[model samples]
Target: MELKEITDHPSYPDAYWAAGDEVFQLMDPLDAKRTLRLRANLNHNLLLHRRLFLADTSILVSPSMFALLHDEELGPGYRQLFRDGSIVTAMRSAANNFSEVAALIIEKRNFVAEMEEDQIWASARLLDSLSPEIVRTDTRDEMLKIGHDYVLRAEYWAALGIPENVALAMTESVRRKREERNLDTVRQSEFWEYARDDLLTPGEAGTAQQIRAYMSIASLGTMAKGIGIPPIYPAAYGPNVDRIYGTHTPWEHRADRRMKLLEPFDQKDPRRLDEERNIHEIAALLTADQVSKIRDKVEHRKLLKGAQQAIQESGNSAAEILERALEEFRGYLEVGAGEFLVDWEGGGRRSLLWETKTGQLMRQFSSGAVGTAAMIPGVGPALGTALTLFGWRRAAKLEKWREGFREVTQEAINDPTIIPELRTDEVIELSLFGEIPYSFMALGGDAEEQD
Candidate 1:
């Protein structure tokens, strides 16, 4: 039950624990071995999920994802990805989401039945030891925004026919509590609890339930807590209505604008429901890949332009500029074709393959007789050939990428190391180079129509 006992187990090596001050000092062979193993494990896991999450900045783990990562079967595998590094694993706030998770565990008492009390304690200890980052939002300006969002949400609910008195009371309670506690900001943990306890009489829970239902209908699930459906929603859908709209629109006009944007649709209309689903699927695909693709294109263009200008200004021949451009393109290809191998603890190694849209273009260019023609004296012909072959072999490569993505997606589902967040629908969208098929847009479209 003790921390030392839990960490010292054969399955849990010393490498798993945070290194102490002794690690900074000169170490014997045993200490050296421990540090080396720790470094290797951290590096291996970093490479595993970096491609999937594009977590060059930070990986923000939701409460659900965090708990799932700590589950008995999946814990060890997912923990590998959370190793101490420059790219941190962070929760939104310690006083917010993390506290909610603790509260949930206490409330259920058997939420994770297999997780013994001591194990739970040890898990908390491990989290402390790892020192995963927390996003701070306690500044004065942030608190003002937070307060505004609370009132905005309340006003939205009132617009949807919740009693004006009820809505005012809810917002007023929050304002009163902030003053009473001498707090600038209300953490998510405090806000939700306050809403439930103070929204109505002590025994009345109906108002809180109603508010929750309305929030769900609007695709707003604890916006202050963590990542939700809003991030994946298109800009026109008013995803930033809670925070950004308040800054531009005055309080009086805000409700009308939000109501128009978030107008309720017929839940029973199959066509309407289908359209909503399609929009979400398309949005998720765009969120995951299209933006990245656009950025890559812009960057590629800049690189080519820069290369040409440098060569031309230096009094280089046209061929030299072309050669420089080609070198830049080749470097882009190398970086885009991200192929890495994962060594499994069970013994065998598996490969994770990723290719940018340009990789396919490169393949098509290299395949045709035009590629031979591209060997002319000037670089103009080669550039023309490359551009011409951009859409060539599209169908074949699309199919190949789709199949490969599906296989890796399956591997992700079965393997805990790779988070199973990628969807087949998104893969199909990516395969089409960000195009959503008409069938995908239709109600109850046949599976065969996907091709």
Candidate 2:
């Protein structure tokens, strides 16, 4: 017997025959419209599932949601899902998504610390919940090796329309540039005065990079000590620090300070630096008498202490002072030496918030040092320290990416066709196989049955 005839008059069980018959019907021209509609629905379901899965994962790992999962009144439903292994599935999905995103960022060398802040908090919570034995296990290391292998084979640079070699070289160039900047900053810093001979007695070709990393931590320690704040080392330091220091100075104020200090060192555009240089050159053209007369006409500008003074004047307790000082130091690393600038007799500072090109460069160098230190094994755990050191410009990039995800989720929610109503025929067909279509379940079909 021919295949069509056998399928049409099969002696198989009813369930098997029903599945085969559905496939045959799908292939028939008489059922063409239904087949196309089914295909469209399948595509829509896949798209919707992807969007929902991502959103669910984000919410699940969010700090707010993680805290809510402990609530007595509202925790039972989520706890039940955990017991049934749904939460595990969601967490695994989140891990995979994070790994992929991390691989892309590593390949592109566009490290955005704030974008991973939520995930880092989630991972910290998981570690905190685990037993000591589980925490000591090498499962995370093994998983990271697996992720590294997958990234190597995936060739993520291909997606960026660049060759792997070029992408790698670009990453290397950025690393080299950062290292050089860190070295320069260390040499210029007060810490460098004490540690120069130790660092410069180079034993290896990459000694500078090693020293740069060390300087980052040493500088942090020095800064903390200078402010009379004892260093606190928690397994997950970032979120804890944020909660403690958040009340002292707003992130907006810190960000504004960072921008003012680092704006002249912007690598993407050299116009600002050039414009400043031109102004200095024009000043040099003026005679000494003329420059002295112009300086006399300018208003005297006193250095603004701002947050530093506010923290000191708050009259808080010892512990409170330490916390505020740590927060202040965090801001200082971001702005560098410009955090304390003085007006000179020869130069009339016109701007109320005056930071020279030299000051901006110093800020960049200091940032490089602190950022390098944050990557060390145990030094910088606080999120605020890492975020401040890494630069606030990345926050803008993160917001843009988040807005795109929000738009996609909104579009999916608004589209009626993406999750169509289940018809009786479809329900009966799916039920024959001892299964219910997800669309039906999603549309509250299982709720009534459960009750």
Candidate 3:
């Protein structure tokens, strides 16, 4: 292939050339102006080095534009809390980034009306705003959002283990060849993709969105090239994007990470065989339905058997194996939760749901693999809600609660002593029920199942 084929022409940093100029122009960090060459360069940096080089100090960040505006400190840095509650810390580059990010706040306050779609326009209006100004004197931080977050995202990808250059190249390749024109793509791609997508939607789809995640993801590059977007709709039928997105959820993370085609940062391949095996072995235990959800899309399963065998030979119980695998897999979900969040009730439930999914995942691949994670734990709010729980007990409790709750319903009649009129909820909806069981009463207790 020509250099231009692999590395987008002229943009030394970009990995591939794009199909359309209009979309590429829109990608400019300035949002208002860009050249085909600049777009390609930005694309190259994002894909190769995963770096976003700002030649123009005019870039600024609008505070009102961010989700964590209230939580973020406008220092010389860009940071975020991780999916697991860890902090994603980044220092301000000499490229005159964050200060400009700060100044962009004011300028973009009226940014909402600028979006193409009504939903997107409304969203831009809602974001935190930066008081932006024209660059005066050698102002490094005059505030203009860079046209690229590939660099930041590339660092994140490498830190997570994909090759830095590979990420850069892949990003450029897709960018040059295609144009991501929707919110869903951003959520799954890098930070910039997410930011750009987020900029267009004022009100998020909550947990239930309207995008078909798995199929959309599959279409991004090679995986979905001819596959066409899956009828991700539940049972391949639904108008809600979230249902389709939901269908994509399980395989999406694995597939995204599995497509870890990036060259290792050090030139040597950083293929995580052990990690790959863990996923397949884990998948083996999932049900056929679950396996079907991911089997075709995530190609790394075949590559994981050796590592899975090695891990299996270690005598670690299925749960132990899954835990280790999840530690490595966590970033793909890439859902942000704040650090120092002591309550698992929210994030905790989500985590448990993830684990339970693994367990089901184990069973989904093959019945033989089902028992593998059995020794692990169950899922749901009961087991996940706790701060101190782990091991078989946590799983056991989750299973018991799930089993019980599945069959539970509101009692037919209110108790005589539990007067409906006198009760007002000082706490949970449990108050609405008036008389509550002592066990489900406390958050600590509700977080787990009683023996």
lDDT of 1 by residue, 1-451 (tens): 1111111111100011111111111122333233322222223222211111111011221222335345575345445444432223223232333334444454534132333555555455555454443333222344455446543356644544455777777666766766776765543333445555666663344445434323321222222222211111111111122122211100111212211111111112222212222222222212112223422464446544643343233212432343445345445433442222122221112111112142122121111111000111122121111110111112112445435434433432343111112111110000101111111111112122211
Residue ranges of candidate 1 with Cα displaced over 4 Å: 1-67, 84-87, 91-121, 131-140, 146-157, 198-451
lDDT comparison, 2 vs 3, better candidate: 2
**In order, how many clashes per candidate?**
0, 3, 60
lDDT of candidate model 2 versus the reference: 0.24
The alpha-carbon lDDT assigned to residue 180 of candidate 1 equals 72
Which lDDT tens digits does candidate 3 get at residues 1-451?
0000111211111111111112212222432112212222222112111112221111222212232223233211222111111111121232133333333433333122223333332333322122111111221111111113322235433432333564455445434433543221222233334334432443332101211122122112111111111111111111111211111110111211121111111113222323333333332223222222232322223223322432233212433444444443422212221231223333332233223352242222111111111101222222111110011212223445435422221111121111121111110000000000111111111222110
lDDT by residue for model 2 (1-451), tens: 0001011211101111111112112112333233222222222211111111112123323333343345454344333433332222212221333334334334433221222545544544442332111000112332233223321222422222233453354334433544755522221122222223333443321222222222232222222222222222211112112222220001111222221213211234322223222223223223222322222321101011222232233112322332343344333322332222234222324221223252232122111011100211111111112222112222223445335434433443343221011110100111000111111011111221100
- Span of 10 residues, lowest total lDDT, candidate 1: 424-433
Winner by TM-score between candidate 3 and candidate 2 = 3
Reference-based lDDT, each prediction: 0.28, 0.24, 0.22
Candidate topping lDDT: 1
Q: Between candidates 1 and 2, name the one with more favorable lDDT.
A: 1
Task: Arrange candidates by lDDT, descending.
Answer: 1, 2, 3
Query: TM-score per candidate, in order?
Result: 0.32, 0.18, 0.18
